[model samples]
Target: MSSIIKILPDHVINKIAAGEVVERPASVVKELIENAIDAGATEVFIDIEKAGTRLIRVTDNGSGMSKEDARTAFLRHATSKISDDADLEAIRTMGFRGEALSSIASVSHVRMLTATPGSSSGVMVEIEAGNVKSLADAGAPRGASFEISHLFYNTPARLKFLKSAATEFSHILAAVSRQAMAHPSIGFRLTHNKKPVLDLPLSMSVKERAFQLYGNEITENVMLFSGGRDNVHIHGLIGRPAYSRADRTYQDFYVNRRAVKNASLTHGLYSAYGDMLMRGRHPVGFIFIDIDPALVDVNVHPAKAEVLFRNQSQIHDLLRDVIREGLRAHGMPVISTPEATG
Candidate 1:
């Protein structure tokens, strides 16, 4: 009998991979913005049209790629972030997977114009459905700009999965807000349908960035909390008991500056609040945990939004203790165990 299995073509493989990396327009935004940050960009500007279905553009004043690098950047598993497997254990950059560009390009038409600071001219590369349509010299600033048109255009099924424009735009806004909060030193601007949405200048402190994004009403009720033990550091703003939310929607946690969703960490936040928070209410806060990169694995998910900790219990206890102390200092009541009270 003939062999029934065959290796999929590169284009087919890319389309499949795109499903994991580019779930929605917001996913594209997240990947592009993170790539810019990894490029050492101090300023990032994002523009979206029709809630990113029609257009998505991101420009950044960061290290741009050379002609060769730009051409190879869309190839699967090609990355400048890591040289070998050893680097995975100590990953520091926002992107090392190297699949984002290829995945994104496979499903959409992509135009990239990039120039290094030392280069007198720039190169523009146009790709459609993972095929390069054009590559030529172009005049551009000493940075990089990517414009993606008709995302998931070739994949009508994926396009059908997208939510309403407003819903999708809200997701993009949340993503941009998280990235901006994670890196306060980097300026970020966002516009949707040619209307200005967010314009945050470079900030010296996370609190300042918070104020810009969340306004003073929320920021005023937040208190800074910081503490660490055994080489793990936890620091960020926590809302006072009065600033609780109806759900965990406002709770944000970052491990090594990467926003993640971990149940243990969320429970730890609730534990920190203890009896101070009423039943069915959650706290509005941001908690950042810094630990040796080797102790945390960021490869647990394709989106890199989930992580595995080497010592989860220790980290959980540390988070609880740190926020509990901050709450106590702010004159909030903390529930004590019956044993401890006795």
Candidate 2:
């Protein structure tokens, strides 16, 4: 064998990365929503046809990208969130890897229409298999909308791995629900085959948001907490022991407004509530963790779903202890016995 290690071409690299990030149509929905959130969108609409196998469209009224930014967004490693090494540590945005757009375009046909708020005209670009098919001026609103067609067409193996439409659609709804819970101020709508699946309106408080997604039972038992050191602020709703879930699936955590699944913190919460709750029960609530952009690492995963907290232990402890304290404050209620008449 020749002793030579060659660099992979950009197209091949993107496709390989796509396997990790865009595992299914639901994965695409997650990334697109992240982009919209990062753009400061208050309202987001996700439209899926054929369980997102045929088409996935995400429209946002967030601050749209400029023409040049739109054109270069599909290039691998091209990102506006991070530039150098220091930028990685102070990441606040949901997408920092800059891989989602490129990985997405590498595996499917992507059409993007974006325009800044004050721009005279907008630009529309189409890409197929990582190649720019067209870029031109177009009439559009002051936002960005991405339409992905024939999902996973370039990767036949990935297509084979997809489940039934109903199963896939459920995954999409779960993701949308997580994001909606994380950002109570942002309005989100989901549609499948032109029929609405989830339509969540903006809420005044985090509890209201949780109630909308998880129902009143969980929110009714919710105890709110807000505390943090320095630039970090943690505000969330914790359910009472009576309203816990059967599993950890109902317990949701978010860092810097990005919904995440963290085992350590979730486990810590379970441990904290152990005295009050019985076995086979999990907490049902939501937590929004806020830290300075420089303290949290948003580049942990391609999906940007995992965040590396600077003081992860402290964060985990703080969350668990605060919740436990709130539960303890409501001391055990005593029942009065009535005198029996003989």
Candidate 3:
């Protein structure tokens, strides 16, 4: 009898890997945007059709790839972000795993046109279900444009798992908003089905970007804070005691400009409010933490949304202390009652 074990083909392996990275349309948007930013893009435009089930396009003015690089970018485990083991310890760019392009291409139709600066022409590569369908010369700017369509089209199970168009678009919007807030200097524009959702130009400060994305009502009610100790630095806006929320949806945390979720950090943030916050109420604010890359590990998770800090306790204490002092210095303003106003 023949051996029972068999090796899976590259196409099959790619589709299986897609399960981890390309969960939905929003996941595609996130990967593309992060890649654009990693390429030093100053302006990024995101356009979605039918809540990204039909089409998703990310155009950026960044360092585009050459013909050879563009063709090899879709290969699994191929990345320019890191070369050796030591580089992983100090990961700074948003993309490093090299699984994003391969995983995404396995589940959708992808058309990438890219050209580097000083190049007279660009290369356009069309792929479907992990197969390169076409490669030709295309006229394009000195950057890259990724056009993805029919997400999860080849995978019926994945298609069945998606939510409604409205619901999916909301998640995409939230993801884009977080990236925009994290990088205030980058210009971002979002359009859904030919309708404008958000358009923000390059902002000089986080406060200005917050006002543009969140509006005056929320930004006005928050106080800015900046402090740090040793090699760790923390800076962001913290809401007043009166400006509380029913949920933690309003809380955004970024470590080294990468969005992350940490239970200890979240608890520390809530504890800083102390008795000022009403029970079950959460504060609305954004916190950006900057620490030595060696002190944190971002490769713990496949999505890279969860990080492990080398000194969790010390960082938590620093965060709580800085926020507590910020609140004390910027005393909460009194809100007049209805009867008093009348």
Candidate 4:
């Protein structure tokens, strides 16, 4: 028996992970902005040109890092958020899975300038095609400013799959709007080719934030929910029967402040909606979940956009009950709309 396994290079592993995480400009936008949010940024600014194909620059007024931390942030699996299995179980922060920065750096030419408050200087690090080109001290403003130029430059195949500039830009804007809606206290702004597309100056409440992103139709139809059982709890907004979507794009889920996409949980919500939505339509809502972190695994997904729950059924039950109650509270017809009206 020959026991010999080849070890993959770090760059190769990161590139493969990038394939899962960086599906498009939209995914990049989501991951980077989420990092900013995790860093305690009260204000975030995003600038993109050529729909982020040529450039994607994110500037955040957050708790910026020291030079050492900024340099280490590009390393795979290096994170300050969680250290061990115990730390994983109670993830109070948005970015415990430190895969986003590594995956992105693998596929793009990244130049980052980061500074902490009261620091006389900042560190400027340049990475080209997964290789560090330079690291030097530079004069820069506080907080983190990342400039990703020639995105997917090393992977032309990925570039070919990208949509037109207008379409990609629209997708990026939609993602920014979604995050901004979730965090009302966080001021967010987006600029496309030096033109301002969105300017939200810190909303008063989640309801106000939702109204700013979505129209009054959605705001009025939204049903608020918050409940807890044992080690898990749920808090979110589910759309009333009147406000639904053609698909699940409008549905956003967060586990302990980290955005995730759990299809099983999504199904539970749909089941609760009943006949209010047809087979093809989906509901519009944000589902924020809180669970003992040990019971869920976020590392299974390269994008960190998904998780595995130990008691999926229990979580499903929780989601269904809340949604059902929300619907009932809104006075949804006891019978089908068509039948009741008939």
Clash count per candidate: 0, 2, 0, 2
For model 1, how does the per-residue alpha-carbon lDDT over 62-163 read when each residue is reduced to its tens digit?
999999999999999989999999999999999998999999999999999999998999999999999999999999898899999989999999999899
Off by over 4 Å in 2: 1-3, 331-342
- For the record, the alpha-carbon RMSD of candidate 4 to the native fold, in angstroms, is 4.0
Kindly list the per-residue Cα lDDT of model 4 for residues 1-342, writing each as its tens digit.
Answer: 997898899999998889998988888888889888888899999999889988899999887889899878988898889888888766667677778888899999999988889999988999887788898898888889888888888888999998889999988987898788668899988989889888888988877777777769788878887776888888778887766778776688878666777878887777777777877888888888888887887667766767888888778877777667667777875232211110
Residue-level lDDT tens digits of model 3 in 253-320: 99999999998888778778767789999998799999999999999877778999998888887888
Q: Estimate each model's TM-score.
A: 0.97, 0.92, 0.95, 0.89
* Top-scoring candidate (lDDT): 1
Query: Which 10 consecutive positions of candidate 3 have the poorest summed lDDT?
Result: 333-342
Candidate 2, residue 199: how far the Cα is off, in Å: 1.7
Steric clash pairs (candidate 3): none
lDDT of 2 by residue, 1-342 (tens): 997989999899999999999999999999999999999999999999999998999999999988899989999988888898877767777788888999999999999999999999999999999999999999889889999997889799999999999999988988898888888899988899999888889888787888888786676778886666677777787777777777877778888888877877777567667656777878766777787877777767767678787777777777666666656665522122222211
Comparing 1 and 2 on TM-score, the stronger one? 1
Better of 3 and 4 by lDDT: 3
Candidate number with the higher TM-score (3 or 4)? 3
Q: What is the overall TM-score of model 2 with all chains considered together?
A: 0.92
- Segments of candidate 4 deviating more than 4 angstroms: 1-5, 334-342
Task: Give the residue spans of candidate 1 off by over 4 A.
Answer: 336-342
